[model samples]
Target: MLKRFFPDLYVDSIYHIPYETLKKNQIKGLVFDIDNTLVPFDVATGDQRLVTHFKELTRLGFQICLVSNNSEERVTIFNQDLQVEAIHKAQKPLRRSFKKAMKLLKTNPKTTAIIGDQVFTDVWGGNRIGMTTVLVRPVVDRDEWITKIKRGLEKKILKVYLKNSNNQ
Candidate 1:
């Protein structure tokens, strides 16, 4: 059903998420998708702005984790400096990785949120686990071919979702 792809919140990007609002709601942990969520896939590392933003989040006492379907090599190299708990090749839209992410954060479903650019994987998985899901627009136009294909389908879904939301 379309509900699986419906995010609890949709924003222009991760930067647009209201951290204070989430904190007020008692969200204690955040699970993020690496590529195109925090940074574009082509960027070798998080930029200065992203680094500062993440530092701020940590300073505010939020546990963070990177749950990416990307290979260990890519995730490892990208996270060397970030140093957050991370799981690569997460096989998302499945419950196992979501549970693993919660354990890594020492948090439970009620206090955790998933932030990513993809609906099928991030939104669906988070929604299935009763976690709040935040969908952000992709950072770049270029991506792996597989993801590019998903983008096409996601466009259609988003259109319907937006239309329905407006009707409501």
Candidate 2:
């Protein structure tokens, strides 16, 4: 149950994630959430650091795709600038978008991982599809109202989970 709620993996920051770790995990592809994960929600494009990381991942032979709940306009701006395939209005935690992303990457779920800041959408959707899920702290905490509420609940659950883990 705890495993179901928590992400399969956690990283301090997406930039710090090692390519070797993904290789060891047998992850040949990755689906990423854009806003607040790769960059702040308010920011329109990725920073130089993120662009460099993306290049490194591509060089490492890992297929990358962006799956975001944001509008097409927003995603288009990202895709055009980042030069990567992306699906907007993903409706994550539903599996449809993730499936579509996998189709685009031509990678099997067994060799794919989903990385994002939010547990409810990114982690849940990845876990539902039997893919490894990675959770990173949000690049920025300010978010939409619904997301803020969800984050609050997620925080509570995470606190409880940590307390229990410490006790055991």
Candidate 3:
């Protein structure tokens, strides 16, 4: 479980991820977590940077979808602003939402990547479904109490993952 939570690629920030890398990896689609991953949880609208990134992703021929455990209201707000397909109340770590996103993208699991800030939810769920995962630092360090607890455990797993990656 812990191993699954650690992504194949870990970056300091999502902005650091290069589109060329995804092309090289043959990734044709992307599933992203909305809150904390794309923007701070408290933010109702996406930033200009994210909007530009979304446009560039489409320009590169990669389909994009947003998946969130947040409520419909929250997700809808983001969808309306970002103009992207989104799944609400995703219940991550379960494959249902991920599968739905794959269906919407019309892409195979082998050709998709999942990018998010959480280890337990985004990384574990994506890895479980055989998609490449990219873990990026959260936009905000402050999170819900439950998420904070999960993050604490995730830190332990991340340390080991970093060590193993170095050895590889």
RMSD of each: 1.1, 1.6, 1.2
Model 2, 33-85: lDDT tens digits are 99899888878888777788889899999999999999999999877757877
Error of 2 at 81 (Å): 2.3
Candidates ranked, most accurate by TM-score first: 1, 3, 2
Candidate closer to the true structure by lDDT (higher is better), 1 or 3: 1
Please report how far candidate 1 places residue 136 from its true position, in Å.
Answer: 0.4
* Candidate numbers sorted by lDDT from highest down: 1, 3, 2
Backbone clash count for every predicted candidate, in the order shown? 0, 0, 0
Ten-residue region with minimum lDDT total, candidate 3: 1-10
Best prediction by lDDT: 1
Q: What does candidate 2 score on TM?
A: 0.93
- lDDT accuracy of residue 112 in candidate 2: 91
Residue by residue across 1-168, what tens digits does model 1's lDDT show?
Answer: 787898988899989999888999899999999989989987878988888888999999899999999899989988888899999999998999999999999999999999999988999899999999999999998888888889888999898888888898
Candidate 1 TM-score versus the reference: 0.96
**Backbone clashes in model 1, listed as residue pairs:** none
In model 3, state the lDDT of residue 128.
Answer: 95
Residue 105 CA displacement from its true place in model 2, Å: 0.7
